[model samples]
Target chain A: MRKQLPPEMLARDSRFVRTSIMDQILDPRNRKISERTIGPAKLAPGRPASADRARNLMHGIFTGEIQALEGAGRTAFDFDETEAPFALKLDMARQCWDEARHVEISIKLGEWMGTEIGEFTEATFLYEAACAPDPVLRLCGVNRALEGLAIDVFNTMKEFGDVSGDPVLEFCEDWMLADEVTHVKMGSDWLRRLTADDPERRERALDFQRTVDKLFSLGGFRGETEENPIHLARKMREMAGFSTTEIDEIAELSELARAEGQAAVEAAGSA
Target chain B: MSDPFKPRPAFAPWDRRELPGLFDVEESARRVGAYKWIETRLFEALGGWIATVPELDVKMILGRHCYHHAWHAELFDKRLPELREMNTDRLCAPANDAMEEFVEALREPDAPELTIEKLVGVFRVLIPRKIAAYTFHLNGTSRVTDAPTERSLEFILQDEWNDWREGEMLLQSLIDTPEELERAIRRQHELEAIVVRAGGITGLGTIGATTEVEGAGV
Candidate 1:
């Protein structure tokens, strides 16, 4: 037996029917085209040699993404404790759900690429990177760092998806990018609060930034040369709250990665 | 073991009036002090990452957490005067030390940004576990009170449980990359050791050990 509430009472209560940002973003009414006509009818040059490989990679990425979303959810829950400011808790809750949707969208994209979500392998770098014990660090690494990169990745994918006339990928990228911006903003706000008084903490955050640079500098399999290396890396950092100095460091790191990646490719060609 | 006097539901949503003796000025003051220390540490850690990490999302999230913690501190302040007579020396002392250590860690000049592995290890592995323990303690004692304090604790406990779940998921997701994942796993072990060392010094456990120890001394 459940208690029944009047319509007026139910309507008056805000929490009972709270709609998340994800719900708004994923609504079918927002769809511009049907799924049938969304993706490419034919594969492009330099596309992964096999759709199977592409699907596998996408599945791995999606699994990592989902895990990060779960972590963000936990942080939000903890913040809810001690009576965290109502508005902040609400915002965190919103971000948690958005991340969940981002994972779902990515999974769908993986399916479109022709692969099922894969099992967690020992080689999952993104998964490991997000396995921190501190709330601040978890937020910094997953939401700010990984998802920050994701914003750039999605934007680039959106451009490619649009040019390739792949409406499904484009739609996914667009919605994800919008949600990521808010997620990044949430991380920035929280990071600022945590480090306001301490210079050492600021330095450590900068160090993490450098790590991001090193990790992403390897460039993606899709085509490193095609990407706007400097702009892509710099913009992501800037959004994550890097200062002018830190941004310069990131740029330097990106250039180094390009050089190294090129050298490896040339060596392989020669061999 | 079921008493007729017990509430029908094992886990009913909390009602403030049910817990009458929980919100003593002294206890509230102690909890506020502990929360303040935790808030400061969280802020410092997040700030450290933002300054170093080039990833926009990481910076944004850290900044958000920092702001929220500051707000928590402000709210705690509002409750301080009410317990002005309570001896908060013990609660305040270890917090001071932790704050000092955090500041020292932050001011050490620039280096390579911590690897995602390291950052996540610290944030997701260590911090959430400690918070969970703290919340559990509160939950265990909260029901003993027949006052509003129990209600507040209930709310916090629910939140902490959610936090733990999310943190575990984050940790599990790091399986994508070997190197980064390994580093995070190592760091988690290291955090456990550090927390254990700190735990013994303060009887109230790791999350608020300093404050608890300080309160005991007072």
Candidate 2:
């Protein structure tokens, strides 16, 4: 019966305190951090501060899993069966459990890497994406875009685990990475099925997807190059039902976001 | 909500529908509607808790129990068209205002720290009544005339029973101390009064099978 529940109303224990993404963006340290890094921030094992960088990313993953669980639950509970198909809601419910497990896994992983639950601040963008009024839009934004970002992040972490010789991290990331791929595939299937007869609606959903993808790109944090910490998982994405063209489109979007972020950093430096 | 589901037969409104079954179409629709509404409320509430409950085991159980409710609601929804009423939404509603009030109280223990309260409300208060109602329906309805409804009940009861046991074990495990047991007991008594007053999901007469309210309201 609770419909259109806002992200602010999301229940969290005191330990799960959140920080606004806007605050992180506006922090003066971003300018210095961006300036200090000559190129895309490399997340390789040999890179400077790689361990701390991995911890931060791991903490982010932990928070992201919690938000993903919330997103899936909201999508399952918010819309009427008329708006969201029973099958889609079923999928959303399934995704809820998967994301919950991912949260537990990420929590343990965070501990293994010397991180606390909220050592790094949390963002509600994933939950915000789930708040879309339209079910298709919700699917596109949360399941495809946000969960798609999870695929990239998890893939990067898995690779980090493999290269860094951390079997626990690598195994856990690989396990969760498979779930993310399935979640994306579920979204992709629902997106096409729901919008089959309505091209305009499909376009709207895809547009919503693009907007969320850009939000998640987080400047150059996720991209195809080594400068980015999380590279787009094209092969994994293709397996998840995203076409090469869709992947290309996301890469293009990330490039634009990174360019704009660099410009903002430069402007901050001059000021 | 759309026609993405398999096509159902377009049953025309029956003329002078037979009364061989325990529940006539109007009464059947009312019961079915109430059941659908309750199942959906359960599903939505459980779905919400899957993310909020701090305990991982509770979250895991809720994640699965929530889907069973969703399926139960869908089964009721699918059964609606078989009756005289084509519009299932009108039929699908709370049995009475007190039932509505019960739902209001049922969903209040939503905070992360209120896992005990949440489990008490659901497993201790609501689900037991649900199983009893479904069992009553199974016993009262004519197997030949109301077979599909019975079929749905059979499927739903399996889940209801399993979820209740699982939830009960969880409730027991969480209650390590006397104060925890007291918390669970107090919460149960508080909601139990409301559910008892509301006459449970099917009301005082299970499936309205009694003579006092033939073709009465849901």
- DockQ score of each predicted structure, in the order shown: 0.02, 0.27
* TM-score, every prediction: 0.43, 0.79
- Residues A1-271, model 1: lDDT tens digits: 0111111211111111223333433444433322234333122324445344334445545655544543443344334334334344445545545655666677679768665544323133454454454455655676676666676566666665687677887888788777777777777786677677876875676467557556665532222344432135345546656567755665566667656655555554445
* Candidate 2 overall lDDT versus native: 0.82
Could you tell me which 10 consecutive residues in candidate 2 chain B have the lowest summed lDDT?
B209-218
Q: Model 1 lDDT vs. the true structure?
A: 0.49
Clashing pairs in 2: A40-A227, A82-B1
Each model's lDDT comes to: 0.49, 0.82
Q: Pick the candidate with the highest TM-score.
A: 2
Off by over 4 Å in 2: A37-40, B1-36, B49-61, B71-101, B108-117, B134-162, B165-190, B204-217
Local accuracy of candidate 2 as per-residue lDDT tens digits, A163-249 = 999999999999998999999989989998999999999999999999989977776878999888789999889888888898999
- Candidate 1 TM-score, C-alpha based: 0.43
